[model samples]
Target: MNGIRKALRDGLVPPPPSAEPVKHRDAGVWTIPNLFTLLRFLLIIPAVISIFYIDERPWLPLTLVAVFSLTDWVDGFLARLLDQYSAIGAKFDPLADRLGLGLVVIALAWEGLLPWWAIVIIATVDLFLLFFILLMDAHQAMRVNWIGKFRTALTMVGVVAVLAGPAFAQPVLSTIGVLCVEVGAFLHIITGVQYARLAWLGRRRFR
Candidate 1:
């Protein structure tokens, strides 16, 4: 449990008192995990372009979405499997998530696959997390927060469901996906609060 906690600290959870400070990131920025993340990023523009052709070639964007979702898991899995974790992946992976989600959601909305409120909700959640990160000076810590994984996992699943639902003519899946996204937004706020409290305690005690 403690090891799991340490591994996911990505600047959100602070170390407990007397715990050794995390140091010397052992992985390179160019590791297989990071490259998977990079692939998601590199394909974003193309994905958006494909969305425009959804009526004609829905397969294109849907295929890309599937790939994006797969990489989301693959990158994290490879990070742990290959033991190639890096500060870059810790920080940049989430950044890419937010960025990719924002742009893709916007495109989806434009294509009438999603409503505008979904876009607002996602952006709001990202902003909420960012606000606390800045407010609490969270970057000094080395571990990634495991709590965010629940939120991210739900989100990734939600996104795929949201798109796949319509493509496959399954309204139920789309509804479930939307529900997951809404729940994820709630979790975002909850985890942001947890990060704030833990970060405050960390800085106060360390000081």
Candidate 2:
């Protein structure tokens, strides 16, 4: 007993416990790390204006959408490169992504360019996932899976292509675009299911 006591005493440091250090990331408002996000927000205004003001150039705002999607990749890369990681950035980044995609999807559907069911499916998936996230709160920090990430990229690419030309004219591209949307839809559903399962298990464990 004396030997065990001495070993623990030597091994453990008797320091007072405290909360983890709060890292206040620089606002980065003027930094390159945040430029992409700013660009994304800026794009929304033009996209809305172009959508309503000009029907002749439907594809023009899609270029903005493409730019917004591309910026998602750019911002993340720049953040990592600059080592400007922050909790605020982490929280709002995904929100920005959802805003961009959701607005486009709804707009396209409203204009009768996109099928209503497709929009419904994606929105339903998002809603279900968000519900579980709210329930799990901190217990389930919703991290994007590789499949989820890939599907999102594919969906963005598909949306851009769909806007670029007639579906029949670009046979291969259209097929791939449809495939990408379908794959994205599947991933959204699967991810939501996974989140719900995790939330349920976590609640059970906590109880």
* lDDT digits (tens) for residues 1-207 of candidate 2: 665454444223322223322344554455675767777877876775655532577567667777888888777666655556654455456656666676776676676556677777878877665565556533233455555566678778876765554423454664565566666766767766765675677557657
Q: Encode model 1's per-residue lDDT on 1-207: one tens digit a residue.
A: 655554455323444545765554657677998889999899888988888887777567878877887787678766755578776676667667767877777787787766677567777766665554444433343233565667777877887887777678788987898788778766767775665566567557757
Off by over 4 Å in 2: 1-31, 52-54, 128-142, 166-176, 195-207
| C-alpha lDDT of all candidate models, in order | 0.70, 0.62
Per TM-score, the best of the predicted structures is: 1
Please give the lDDT score for candidate 1. 0.70
